[model samples]
Target: MAVVGGGIGGLAAALALSRAGHDVRVFEQARAVSEVGAGIQLAPNATRVLRDLGVLAEIERVAVRPEVFEFRRWDDGRLLSSTPLGAAIEQTYGAPYLHVHRADLVRVLAGAFPAERVAVGRRCVGAVRRPDGAEVRFADGSGTAADVVVGADGIHSAVRASLFGARAARFTGYVAYRGLVPAQRVAGLGLGRRSTVDLGPGAHLVHYFVAAGRLLNVVCVLEESSWTREAWTDPGDPAELRAAFTGWHPTVRGVVEALDHPLKWALFDREPLPEWGAGAVTLVGDACHPMLPYAAQGAGQAVEDAAALAACLTGASAADVPAALARYAELRLPRTTRVQGMSRDNGTRFHLPDGPDQLARDEVMAAAFGLSPDIDWLYGHPVPASSSGGREGARRG
Candidate 1:
């Protein structure tokens, strides 16, 4: 198996397949594997998959386990709701919600695979499927044929364009500024130890500790008419960011003010693809269905995809590859599509304008956070067992 794009999804697919006793090679366009941002929230579903893959212990060492997720008003720091996540979530879901540095998680996955198996700077130009296998061509005028090709390239996937042709990604009309500050620095500002979301009129601020409380990751998303660029590493003007949340709560301003250098990303998402597999090739992660950050499941869903793909392909014959790929798609498509829709809906709900609706939303959140079952469907559900082979897949599914 050959996995394209050495981001988290690609590396994860390579690791999972190799662990399943297959020879897998991962091709990454970057010179090295490194994440651009500060933090990623790994809900229980994703953590359980990683735990099964045998990387959970290493992840836990560097990840922060927050006790609660608190939502507050942007104007006066009034607490609207708080969801208990540490013990309650683990007891219900079978795993803890982990907040870790993106780079740390990438390192964990990359280290699990043999160094030589990951070919960096090998940009995938296109791929062609044959009766026997699939041929992947790289921009450096080289090619490799493998029994299966997985396109985990992400939202701007080259393999996706080569297969489905070019389709514009819908801009959500929002720009996000993200940065990480030393936790000690945040503490000096008198900010308490907690995960916080300050909901304002047209924007919101999410702050949380990561890297086991060594650093605080801050993300601020605001509605905008146009974007300067789409890159996650684009330089952002802190002054502009401060101005956007000018009159926000003092805590919100303190989090933004603690930033040294911040990067801005123009948020965009796509409707779920009608198909994820073609011949001996299939797509995973953002390449198949990109979602907004509201649900904090963009990376989580990709990790889920990797686990499902590995489960479907394990112990399958060459003739069974197509059926396996279809089964993977059939199992993942509906769930991811629902998540994508929910993320969009949550974005609107979070940025609701002032009215009875906003008041009602606040009331609902205040009440929902107190209940254990209100969020069980999201944080407690496990991935369904794979159904490729009758009993074996069922056991792992």
Candidate 2:
């Protein structure tokens, strides 16, 4: 099998398929396989898959276990809602919820994936289905054929574009600034081992412990009527960041001020595709369903997609590849689509102006505080995996 893009979803898919006793290779666009981001929240839905992949323990070693997730009013710093998330969540969900630096998580996954099978600097241009299987084409004037080709490539996936025509992503008119602040710098402020978000009109700020509580990851999102930039690597002006949060709580302002450099990127998500793939070629992760960051399930959903794809493909023969890909899509599409919608809805609620609707939203949240059942579909769901190495195609090497 050929997997395009060695990102979290791609690596997880390769690892899951390998453990299910299949041979897979991961092709990464960059010269080196690394992740560049602030932090990622591994809700139980994701940690369960990482545990099954056998990397959750290593990940937890460098990750922080937040005791609670809370929301507060932006101006007055009044707590609006709080949910317990440490031991209680682990017991109920069958996995731990964690916050880890993106680089650390990628390092652990790369360590587990077979290095020789991973080829960096190979940018996949597109893919085409053959009678027997599928062929993946690269920008380097090279191509490879496999029984199945998976496009784990991200939002602008070339494979997706190749199978389905090009479609532009809809920008949400929101830009996010992300940075990590040394925990010690904010020690005096008493920011505990918990995830917190300050909600305000037209904007919101989230901060949580990561890197075993050594750093606090801060993500501030603001709505802009006229600003339209999309690059993810653009350096943000700290002055502008501070100015944006001028009237926010002191703690919120302090977090922004401590960041020496923050990455600013316009938020964009595509409408879910009617179908995830065709023939023996299929997509996983953001390639198929991209969601806003409001729900913090972007990474979690991608992890789930990997596990589902592996489950559907295990025990299938070369002739069964197309059916397996189709099954993978059938299993994942609804869940990811629902999540995409939920994330979009949350984005709208987070930026609601101070009005009756905002007050009603706050009341609903406060009333639902500490109710894990409300999110059971999200945190309590499990991704299917093969208990034994699958049928005739099982390759133990």
Candidate 3:
């Protein structure tokens, strides 16, 4: 099997398939495989897969196990909902919820993946359909063939485009600015032990400690109708960011003011596809389902996709590859689409202005206080592995 664009999804997919006893190769666009300084959440739904792959132990060295997840009102910093996440949640879900620096997590995953099978500096331009097998063409005028192809490439996936033609992502009219602050610099923000978010009209801010609680990751998302920038390379002005969230809680302001430099990118979303894989070629991660950060499940869902894909491909015969890919899509599409839809709904509630709706939201939060079942389904779910590694094509190295 060959996987394209060795980002988080691709790496995880390769690792899953490799462990499932499949010979896997990964092609990454960059010359080196590394993740940026941002932080990512690993809910139980995702941690289960990483644990099975034997990658979470390394990540645990640098990950922060937050005590709780708190949602606060934007203006006054009043707690709307505070859900316990440490022991009780862990005991209930069979895995811990963690916050880890992206680089550390990537390093941990790369350590587990077979290094020789990973080729860097290979940008996949598109896909190829040949008589015998599936293939991918790289920008370097070379190509490789494999019995199966997985497009773990991200939102602008070349494989997806090659399969379905070019399609533009619709802007969500929102922009998110993310930055990291040294834990020492902001020692008094009073958010020391939890993943917290302040929600309000037209904007929201999330912050949590990462790197063993040595650094704080802050991300602020706000509505922006006039601005239309689309890529991660788009630079941000600190003044504009501060201005957008003006009059927010003082601590929230402090998190923003502490940004020596930050990355700001416009948010975009794709409607859930009726299908994500066809024949021997399949898609995973953001390539098939891209969701807003509202649910904090972008990485989690991608991990799930990789696991499910590997599971479906397990124990299939050479001629059964297409049916396996189709089964993979059938198993994943409904869940990912439901998540995509739920996340889309989250934008509305997270950005509720000071109105009756906000009041009702606050009331709902108050009722839950420290134990909101609102996310029980999300936190309680785990991706199960397929135990079918003994079929016709299972003898491959």
TM-score of each model, in listed order: 0.94, 0.97, 0.96
Error of 3 at 1 (Å): 0.7
Clashing residue pairs in all predictions, respectively, total 2, 0, 0
lDDT of 2 by residue, 27-121 (tens): 99999989886898999999999999999999999999999999999998989999999999999989999999989888899999989999999
TM-score of candidate 1 on Cα atoms, chains taken together: 0.94
| Residue 91, model 1, lDDT | 85
Deviation in Å, model 3, residue 379 alpha carbon = 2.2
Please say which candidate is ahead in lDDT: 2 or 3. Answer: 2
Ordered by TM-score, highest first, the candidates read: 2, 3, 1
Q: Candidate 3, after superposition: displacement of residue 336 in Å?
A: 0.4
For model 3, the run of ten residues with the poorest summed lDDT: 388-397
Candidate whose lDDT is highest: 2
For each candidate in the order shown, give its overall lDDT on alpha carbons. Answer: 0.83, 0.88, 0.85
Worst 10 residues of 2 by lDDT: 388-397
* Candidate 1 local lDDT, 1-397, one digit each (tens): 8899888888888877776767888888999987876788998989988887889999999998888888999888899999788887788789988899999999998888899888888999878887976878999899999989999988888888888997878888888899899988778666554667888788988888888789998999899887656454587899988888888887788889888688888899898889997888899999999989998988888888888898888767777888889999998999899889988987888898878999999998888765445256666657544332243322111
- Candidate 3: C-alpha RMSD to true structure equals 1.7
Q: How accurate locally is residue 222 in candidate 2, as Cα lDDT from 0 to 100?
A: 90
Ranking by lDDT: 2, 3, 1
